[model samples]
Target chain A: MEDRFEVSILLDFYGTLLTDKQIDIMNMYFNEDLSLGEIAEINETSRQAIHDSIKRCYKQLKNHEDKLKLKEKYLNKKTEKENLMKELSKVESIDNDLLEYIDKKLELIINI
Target chain B: MEDRFEVSILLDFYGTLLTDKQIDIMNMYFNEDLSLGEIAEINETSRQAIHDSIKRCYKQLKNHEDKLKLKEKYLNKKTEKENLMKELSKVESIDNDLLEYIDKKLELIINI
Candidate 1:
């Protein structure tokens, strides 16, 4: 099975669009790593109800991702940042201040 | 007036999402730097019609950009790339091969 970690990543991109209750449940399930029963206990709902809500919310996040692809572009930029950083680390003679400047700029590119 | 060049930049980021006809007219107006009458002559439509269409399509492009901010992010990354390139150019001690690789990878980050 795929890792639940992806849900949290998707949440980072799209969590604001989701309802407050949905975001709460998702945080508990994905961020807190709580099972449905644990979430249900805190929310005063049945485990089955929490399960259904989580399923629906996951679908919503996936739909948003499929349409906008913000996460995909972010991952691509991040990979580029990593590759450039590796190259920067290998060069022995570059100045410390220059290295720091390049590093910060590279991160700024990926920060979007 | 704001630069018409911006529409072309926005088109580069969000053009495919626009309809074929809208994109065609946008290209004629922004890319070709054509006036409304010039666009209408080629499309066999009135200048007013072409004007309205351009207005609508510009609005559509703005809407997509508003929701996604892909253009904003793209510009940010591009600026970051530019700054890094400038810094690289000033550093005379860096090896040519390493410099080229860094430039290419920095471009890759903004490619998205």
Candidate 2:
């Protein structure tokens, strides 16, 4: 049950939960497109520190994902919700019963 | 310019470029939170195939990011656009000059 989550969940969670500096570096390097040297310069840290912070953040993110599986669950629910939305969107006309069914499905998606 | 792009750009592009089967496996395992075993059973492929596909996808994504730098540029531009929008939204009153400035900024954002 727990072993089924994606590797990126760890990465995302780690990115979210780490120190602001670490998150900044990760976002800059991974999300923002900054080089290690540039990040080091901006943050006034060494390139090695930036590199080590990234590696550590990666490990932590992976470990958390492996243990918690929250990101995986969230992603699965998101994908399911998206698919349901696509299906609903494709229906040009909806009977009352179908609309009610879709409303219930949407409720489930929103709650998740 | 090239070295500054985030790592995930590569991943996203690779995910887009791969075979449907490979993409499906990736979305299920990484994006959809399916287990390797579960994905294997659904796809009727071996666990090793799933593992290898993920690894290969990761490599390709990284290579593309390193080579093209498209993702990084896109992200930086996106972040800047978001910030500009945020700034524009915070203004309670807009004079003609300010409105014109914002319109130009919006046009740039839209074109990007």
Candidate 3:
């Protein structure tokens, strides 16, 4: 489950960098939790081909992540935004209404 | 000048997807305003080779921008954030201090 989740996150960041076939296979394998044999059936390829394609997809995705670190930077920014929200919540002297407004805006920015 | 600026902005969003040689050549040609002959001299390549590389780099960058629209989306977001800041500025009856604080925060978010 953990491995699948990590791959999904990587796909989110670097999926566009992949070929359409690699992306489709990855979506089935990681997102849909499809087995290699099932993917082979759907892709109309042999199990060995499906296996190799998935392996290559993983390698390419990991290589992109390693070179760009887009996923890592994204996660770091998420953490930073969360921390900022916490600190904003802790501010005691600001008007409560303004703080609430700011909190709402912060959530929007982080989601972006 | 306008074309060069547009290319530089495109490079900013999609440059990591490019080879290091492409990036270096682009930086020399665009950012440093180097002529093809100057770049060729520095790279120890023929001027025609430098020219061809730059042309290919432009095509590749344009292709990436066309597929992803990252630069267009980035420009749109910048405009949206600026519009948002304007709207935030026009709100009446809020504490001017709180408004100033919010403006600063908004700037930070857009710059991110």
Which pairs clash in the backbone of model 3? none
What tens digits encode model 2's per-residue C-alpha lDDT throughout A1-112? 1121333345454444567777777677776677889999998989999888877877776665564444654566456555544554555543455545544544342232
Instruction: Give chain B TM-scores in order.
Output: 0.82, 0.64, 0.86
Q: Write the per-residue lDDT of candidate 1 for residues A1-112, one digit (tens) a residue.
A: 1258888888887786788999999998888888888999999989999989988999988887786676898888788777767767767887777778787877777877
**lDDT (C-alpha, whole model) for all candidates:** 0.81, 0.58, 0.75
List the pairs of residues colliding in candidate 1: none
Q: Of models 1 and 2, which has the larger DockQ?
A: 1
Using DockQ as the measure, what is the rank order of every candidate, best first?
Answer: 1, 3, 2
For candidate 2, what is the TM-score?
Answer: 0.37
By TM-score, the best candidate is 3
- lDDT for B98 in candidate 2 is 49
lDDT of candidate 2? 0.58
Q: Which candidate is the best by DockQ?
A: 1
Cα error of candidate 2 at position A36, Å: 42
**lDDT by residue for model 3 (A16-110), tens:** 77888899989998899889899999989999998888788888878877865656756765666566556656656545775666566655654
Error of 2 at B12 (Å): 4.5
Segments in model 1 whose C-alpha atoms lie over 4 Å from true places: A1-4, A11-68, A94-104, B34-46, B86-92, B95-97
Q: Evaluated with lDDT, which candidate comes out highest?
A: 1
| Candidate 2 CAPRI category | incorrect
